[model samples]
Target chain A: MSAKSVQMVLYPDTHLDQAAETIHRLRQHGIDDRDISVISGVPYSDKILGRPMSWTRIGLIGLAGAVVGFAIATSLNFGTPYLYPIRVGGQPFFPIPTSIVVTFELTMLGLLISTFLGVFIETITPSYGPKGYSPKVSDGHIGVLFSCPTEKMDEVKKGLEDLKPEWVKNPEAKL
Target chain B: MAAETKTLSATHSASQEGEDLRQEHLMHDPKPREEMNGMVMEAMQTTSKKYWIALAIFGLGVLILLFGFWGNQIITGMGVTGKRRPVFWALYITTFVFWIGISHAGTFVSAILRVFKAEFRRPFTRAAELMTTFGLAAGALFPLIHLGRVWTFYWMIPYPNARWLWPNFRSPLVWDFLAITTYLLSSTIYLYLPLIPDLAMARDRSTGWRHSIYKLLALNWRGTEAEWHRLRKAINIFAFAIIPVMFSVHTIVSWDFAVSQTVGWHSTIFGPYFIIGAILSGVSAVVMILFIIQSTMKNMKYFIRLEVFDSLGKLVLIFSMAWAYFFFNEYLLHWYGGYQAVRDLLTFHAQGPTAWVWYTMLICNVAIPWLTLWNRKIRRTPLAMFIITTLVNVGMFAERYTIIPLTLGEQRFPFDWGAYSPRLTDISIVIGTFCLFIFLYLLASRLIPLIPVWEVQEGQMAHSTRKLGKGKVTSVAELE
Candidate 1:
């Protein structure tokens, strides 16, 4: 991204195989996967178009939240009943089954809410900044954006031209 | 050997052998992405006179009923409703449960179907998500209406008090408060997460107020590879995670009654029974809304088709039977126990003043669906589905009524037994909530693009027809 990228192509068709071929040509022109960024209206996994898989920590964060929630729910359930200690003729002081219900709810709440926030954190949303962006991507065009040395710009253009994209343009910064 | 092989092959049935899968399913029959965006935008922008007239009517109802009734309730305290003696929780609770049941359909349909890669779910998922949010909104109002001091709603928030009293974890009501809050948050976030891409799409081709709004909501989403990857992962988490939250919310709500020492309410089956019934009503409500949107809104015909109705109808039937089985399970257990008071409660539900509602429940929820939904023709017709689904909702409402007020009216002491009926304020609040629900939905239809265009396009990309031995069949490529 730092080498000054241009959005190389905007393909009108949603042919998965052809999209893969376009990426293959970029690689043949010596573009690193890190230098290439795929953009489209739909969330298509990279592996589908022969790109490297990207990892996300949302699930792990969810698991961590579940643990934290369980701990809090446990403390509240175990401590609160005894603290209040209202005498119900024969009911036990700390009802574990009842506590389990509260614990379960909190655990799920923690997991779900954390994963939701994880999306915003991972995507750095509400950014509203200038970076690489094209509105045609939302109209279902797959914009292949990549950066290269100034000398290789012509070679990159030639590679993209062979892919027969509907349009090509320099991507305005959307950071 | 060739002749024998041909004869064996002929014995195999290819149901979609000649039918065009594209014509049958929305996924297979996709227009271009641009065309889809145009159609969706048109549906949002093309509200008719009737739409406004309905909105105005509902809006008036909201003003009169909400403020008027709730104000009366606030002034008069809890006695305004039929919550007398043993029948302490009646109409509001019943309706609350009914709304919760309705909310289940959205999460069940959207999250579960996404997990299974059901392509037909692409278009109507937003509609169902809206139902979940609005239904919960309606459901949340009841506890407020039920509160003795309506203004003191914050006491449930677990903030440290002057007396240092906090919300009790042991109380099932607290569990419900926690569960409902969690569910509302999760479902709203769930609704908004997938909506980002569509908001971005809307942002692209709009001007004026719409453009400004979409731009804000779209979160500058240019659909970068990292962003899409993160979005997919997050949605996957939501899909799996929200299902359990959905189940917990209703199951915890069920516990509000189930854990009580009351006769019929103290059953182990209530958790699952309530969940099944919720999904049933939710699915029916979804079908009804889909039918309305398809018939009334512009270009909805492209997104919502008979196939959607048929698939939904099948779910309604399956859950209807599930509800019946659970009803029987709960019934047989009580009947076999032969407890005199429990028997009296059952008799009251079946033969008392409100016995007709119970009978109607049986007919609407069980009998009608069992009889008609099995027929593909009845299931496929949008009008037929609309009617049957409307009945299903009626039956489910009656089912909740039978559980709450009818049983509440019954007493183990016999002398304390009294019949419960809603007063005018109670009735008004219920009507107001119903109007409010529809009003929110009607307004939302204009604000948000109901169709998930990106998901639909992605589904279209995944779907193609491949030639088989004797015919072409629908084949879905796992694009993920």
Candidate 2:
């Protein structure tokens, strides 16, 4: 028979020091960092929690959007005027001063819109499927979610109970 | 024994002072996260009979005054409005600029303050951001209302057409369209980004239809480290990005007049002058709204403390001085140039039939803020700040009134000059926009978490009181 791993949760009150200690102890208990996730009502920096920093591509996406916006503005201002040329008061069809305004506005528009959409893309948002979650997290509690081999569940629970969490149980059953 | 008694007395006095400081500042006063969340949720959920009555009245005002008058204007044509000949842009343009200026309060208070790490901004940033989105909604309507034929407003969009006619990118009007559109979208997104975690909190606690709404709006936020990390990064990007965009928006709006050939309208100083004026009115509007929120909402007194009013009053006072400088610079240059038409316009502004507006602008924007805000007691007093901010906005409106119709009343040739006043439709539409803004705000106050609970909690976490040389002092940690 194959050994299966079970997801467990530990609820701690809103104390960064305590949460940090619990996470440190968990790491010492043979749990890899990738196998554990922390949820809380307030954001804690990775340094505060002694965890690895997470990276995001939102800035890159915003820059890409800016380039696209610049392209559109250039085409509209520089290229379209040639198609239906309407010369006014001996001014050039593509006036640099006026073109700058349109370019700046459009470029910003693209950057903002893409940055907003980037949040959704990066987070896989509007995801409605059931996942390992705890309502206590929103109530300003820190929830530590981790997986352990079914055979080792007893040992992990005993180890976590020493930390004095509110509860330690399988998240699937409680959530 | 005598020395021990003295030391105990001094220690007791220091602790008392520390306690008093906590009472005065929201950051120093820390509440449990659950309690703070409950207070915010209660504030959102609790509504009174007066609230509903006010909402209904504002809603009716919007329907009758805004939409009804606007619809009548559209059907009856532009003749019904006061726009005629040289004074073609009148009250509609003035109010349009006023509301756009009002929208700046949100970005200035929320984004700029966030970037600078102003601790007092924690509770009210959401309120100011809401003002940005709704103020833009109210302000963006005027250009369409001024369009005469509102249905064909899409012609301003840059798209391929059957006749190969594209909007003139060279025209300031087109820039106004682009700038306002970008600002509206950008501010709305900025408002929504900080709101997601709060929405998730609401979702977890709510039931029925409210739960469904928050669930969708929350975007299934789980408060995971990765999600929070990305959200913070995105919010930081927006914080820095939106400031220049905010400045650009009003600068473009100013160009609408500055680029014109009108003697009083053309000036290199208009851009910075308009920007300073906008910030003055914007910050004052924020103070006025904060007073309203603190007074009306439940449990808001705990969050919108007097310290916030004191800090914002300082900003208003500084901006007023800056505005005075620009006002003088613009006036002195025009007076020094000695151009006959420009001099006549300046004289007409002071001695015209509507000279009351010019005086009101001076007294309210300059005299009142200068005299009153310097007193810390008055600045800290909510009611006094409210009255002063309200007058400042009144003064700002008068300033715009002077610039638009009053200035347009003057010309190089006396024969071609004429005075302009808003007719009934124009007045109704202006009042309706105010009603529209209030109505949207009333609804939004109930629907969303007006006070950002997480941000307040985060701030409280970073703040602590420690003893420094036998005196207690509040210290803040750079948590981010």
Candidate 3:
């Protein structure tokens, strides 16, 4: 199946609400949900934009990191005697009470570092090439973009105009 | 205190008569967003001859005092710092505790208030968090410089080596390593996460290399609903986790002293004592920074108003009371037990050569704040609050100094007891750290929007005036 792609831009702040209305209008016209995109300066939630929640895989990754950290700590605490043993203060080589601190610290370190990595991975941050962007978004604006069949472009633009956007224009998404 | 209140109210009324200034000075005098933006931009762009002069002085201080002086100390060994027998932990440790205490305010303001949804906390949380990061950076240095054998510092880590000498995890020193590092990471992340949106704003507004830098930092954020949800969720987890982490970090730091077998250091109450001391010093540090930001930064005067100072003063007052309570508990318990060594230590702290420091700590930490903060007028006055808060910080510094070295100076064995006088190198390094903190803060203020705009707009949305019967009162709707 060959599908044609068409694009348009709306002034982010004034046109976002109308663009959202147009997306609803298009969904009724049988456009798939995946064809629509909304961008803004501040984080606009999925519920507000009528989209599904994006899941973060931070929890699984963080747990994995913690386990690895715990393993290293455990090995260090228990394996030290076989590696090189020395008695101190007439106590045994491995002290249970003292080992807890090392394990706890490493586990925490793992969880935190993984969480930091998770934010970047989940967000796919630092993408700097030209996509669909508008300056008004920074000034408390929101923009919505949707793809449609080339023949239906005028109809969709008309539908968007009826909802009273600030302005709408076709723009290329370079990269 | 009541008498002070009357005197202050009289002064307020007199000032009102002179200026005829209304409560509507900044809030009701609302300006356009564009104008406000220009004000902020201009503030950042505009530099005075005096600013350059001051920067030069601080810059020179940093060069000579921090690097040059620290190099001298490192070269001369720890001996140059006057850290002789029985006074092993001297000026460096005192500054460590002081800097660490200064750091707690940032997390307290940003995380604690963030947890409770305090509307007034909006504008200054970032400013306070910057304090936390910079203060922690400065605070971390004291320990490293104190180490003397700084190159072998990695031995503090618990990593297994060929020699297989396990790090003593039971020691509070090890805990300090873990806890402080955790705190630095957590606070830095917490500071950066909320800053992403603002960075995006700067990216949009800026040009050239600045724009490129901001674009990279802003990431590809488009404020999608899912993105907002994830960001909020991450922030929520951090906010909750960081508070306990903040508490534990200082408690563990307190353990550095409390775990010791020495007379004054062995108190069980040191944990709470240190926590209160941290809050006390931290809040004061916040007030000082807020005052500077408001007076010096352009549109900052609008954001950081009398209400903010009023709220901060109230915190200062409450923490002062808490500090007094902790001090009384610790002092009474020691005095009541009549242990000779503890009693002697207490006596020497009060009447020995360093007695002046004890009194100064009391005056700055307790008396001055207790006397002034009772008055709403004084609390509302930025200059008064700044002076009093500065005093509180000085007093807190003295408290730490007395706790560490002065107490260490008069231990059970008189044969080992000795006085500590900070050498020139010790003094310079301390001055350098202070300069470094202020220098970093200055740089940050220029580069970043010190006021969190989203948080401010959120607060403004929450706040409205409602009239009832004969009075109009401002009320806030809780918004997360």
The clash count for each model shown is 8, 0, 8
True interface contacts reproduced, per candidate: 0.71, 0.71, 0.37
lDDT rank, highest first?
2, 1, 3
lDDT of 2 by residue, B239-263 (tens): 9999999999999999999999888
Selected candidate, larger DockQ, 1 vs 3: 1
Ten contiguous residues with the weakest lDDT in model 2 chain A: A123-132
lDDT of 3 by residue, B300-353 (tens): 777788988999999999999999999999999999998999999899989987
Given candidate 2, what's the lDDT at residue B401? 92
What local lDDT score does residue B478 receive in model 3, on the 0 to 100 scale?
Answer: 53
- lDDT tens digits by residue: candidate 1, A1-175: 3355455567775555667787888789887877777777887777777888777788898888889888878878776555556667778877888788888888888887888778777666443222476777777688776666677877777776756775455576542
DockQ score for model 2: 0.73
Name the candidate, 2 or 3, with the larger lDDT value: 2
The CAPRI quality class of candidate 3 comes to acceptable
**Global CA lDDT computed for model 2:** 0.88
Which residue ranges in model 2 land beyond 4 Å of their true spot?
A1-14, A125-131, A168-175
Native interface contact recovery, model 1: 0.71
lDDT string for model 1 (B218-313, tens) is 877888777887788888888998998898988999999999889779999999999999999999999999998999899999899889999999
Output the better candidate (1/2) by DockQ. 2
